[model samples]
Target: MDQGGAPPVFSVTAEGDDDRVHVAVTGEVDMATADTMFQTALREPTRALTLDLRAVTFFDSAAIHAVVRLSQRFPATLTVLPSAQVRRVLEVSGLGEQDWLAGR
Candidate 1:
């Protein structure tokens, strides 16, 4: 939600086999909606977690914070496929250079 009207249209889906969890997200994510992404992405423990953000058009600091927390909680267990927009943000925020998000 953007806090001015109806909640933003955010969709997150996590699906994978026993050894991994694959997550996909579509839509904007700001302060009001970052928790949804975080909670959904970390719903269960797995040997690995992959986050696909190719459909995401916007993400704010809150979204980055959620990713930081998720990584801190799961350590060395996340792979991210970010859209150009997302990559820009992540690069500006310095997370783009993080090893966990590398080579995606």
Candidate 2:
């Protein structure tokens, strides 16, 4: 969730396979969308997650925190495929090329 109780809704295009989920987020991921996306990942038993952020031009710490927390939950097994903007956020937040991202 970002702020104002607006949780991120998934525009999930394809069905997940082999514990690998392909997600395309198309909105702001501030505090509002944080936990929604986080739970979407955490609740899944997927071994790998590829988040396509091509449509996400805006993101925030809470969103990054969600990813980082999920990465920790998976123990360096989170596979993130983010856009440049999201990549920058991850990098600046000290999550770029970490063990988790390294596996992707």
Candidate closest to the true structure, highest lDDT: 1
Estimate the TM-score for candidate 1.
0.84
How many residue pairs collide in each prediction? Answer: 0, 9
User: In angstroms, how far off is 18's CA in candidate 2?
Assistant: 4.0
- Each model's TM-score, in the order given? 0.84, 0.71
Q: After superposition, how far is residue 15 of candidate 1 from its true place, in Å?
A: 0.7
Model 2's alpha-carbon lDDT is: 0.69
lDDT of 1: 0.83
Residues 2-36 of candidate 2: C-alpha lDDT, one tens digit per residue? 57865444333434877687666766778877777
Please give the CA lDDT of all the candidate structures: 0.83, 0.69
Q: Which sections of candidate 1 miss by over 4 Å?
A: 1-8, 102-104
lDDT of 1 by residue, 1-104 (tens): 35777544788889987678988898887898899999988787778888888888899999999888878876787788888888999999887788677554
Worst 10 residues of 2 by lDDT: 6-15
Root-mean-square deviation of candidate 2: 5.8
